[model samples]
Target: MLRRLALATLATTAAGLGPLPPLPLLAPAGPDTLTVTIAESGHPDADGTFELSCGDKAGGNHPARDKACERLERLAGAAEDPFRPVPEGQPCTQVYGGPAVAQVTGTWRGRSVDARFSRADGCEIARWENLEPVLPLVRG
Candidate 1:
């Protein structure tokens, strides 16, 4: 199933369409990849943009390629979307994590994703932690 998405073949099968008219590969990493960017206000060295590919073999410029790739694969198959933002109006602690922020944009499990992450509050902190190595680990 994962490979199918990389090949851009799952859209047809998963959607009951006999065949998709060939989706143009989104980038050189193919359609099964994500781009992660992290930044810390006033901390230039702490920012970076990485590419992660979880297809035939784990390959990319991410600092933790293997772990990040595996984490994404697991999240892709999980019942809940790991990229989902915390529910609105949900109670969260007032704790302030830090100035770090991140974004993950690309395709995953055959779906498009453009999730933003931060450590501004409890819920945001938890949300940032969910993607683990995909984003940088936050020390609290």
Candidate 2:
């Protein structure tokens, strides 16, 4: 019986019949999508729009989709809120970093996201800068 089974297996291999099915015939699932927009307060020419998809595959119109997704992953790991409020009573520099404002609206890991960013104050500036990996300055 053992010899017969071995012969059958050899015969199947020789006939190009394998246990696994072909992978190409199966269609892959789609990725999740995120929309990001940056608008300069007084400089419309510097505004930009980007789209990013993360899941089974990385895609979308974002120039750095992979890097953006990675940054979002790190943010999730730390349970950090991208829209955290500025610390009360914390004195900030009275300087203007820029007039750039950004908004990120999408779903991440099944959670809805609507984060807004600006470089108006010190804390907000930090928040905006922290997300630089995903949202870079795009001068139109």
Candidate 3:
């Protein structure tokens, strides 16, 4: 059954039919400290920037924890939109956040899309999403 489904998907793609369900575009909102932008194409991609202020104290107890807290606090102040891409006949999950990066994943119209973001400087960052195994499906 799985093989048949795959074959069907391939055939549809070859015929230039539309891909599976499309991912929705979500906007970011909240405190002005954080900003998020999402771009839709054959694959969906997003970019986010976080602005934060380091404490006045030069150094103190729990420096590591303090830094982590600062990072988390910046993330908390930022806004995130729930937008992702969907590939045809494929299911996927999107995971965001790492030591200092954010990521997104999913199947979009029979193609796999991944996006990543990182802090570019002290107050700004950017990210881009890429689609793989390009299919012949038109964006709706």
- Most lDDT-accurate candidate: 1
Q: After superposition, how far is residue 43 of candidate 3 from its true place, in Å?
A: 28
**Candidate 1 Cα errors over 4 Å, as ranges:** 1-31, 41-46
- Find the 10 residues in a row with the least total lDDT in model 1: 22-31
User: Candidate 1: which pairs clash?
Assistant: none
lDDT for predicted candidate 3 compared with the true structure:
0.33
For each candidate in turn, the TM-score is: 0.72, 0.63, 0.18
- Which of the two, 1 or 2, has more lDDT? 1
Candidate that beats the other on TM-score, 1 or 2, i.e. the better one: 1
User: Which candidate tops TM-score?
Assistant: 1
RMSD of 1: 8.6
Worst 10 residues of 3 by lDDT: 129-138
State each model's CA lDDT, in order: 0.80, 0.72, 0.33
lDDT of 1: 0.80
**Which residue segments of model 2 deviate by more than 4 Å?**
1-32, 41-46, 87-91, 137-140
Q: Write the per-residue lDDT of candidate 2 for residues 22-84, one digit (tens) a residue.
A: 234422344556888987745554368888898756789887788877887688679776655
Candidate 3: tens digits of C-alpha lDDT, residues 1-140? 76877787788888999455544664233221212222222333222322222233212222233453344345435642222423355533334222244443442222333544333332212222221101111122
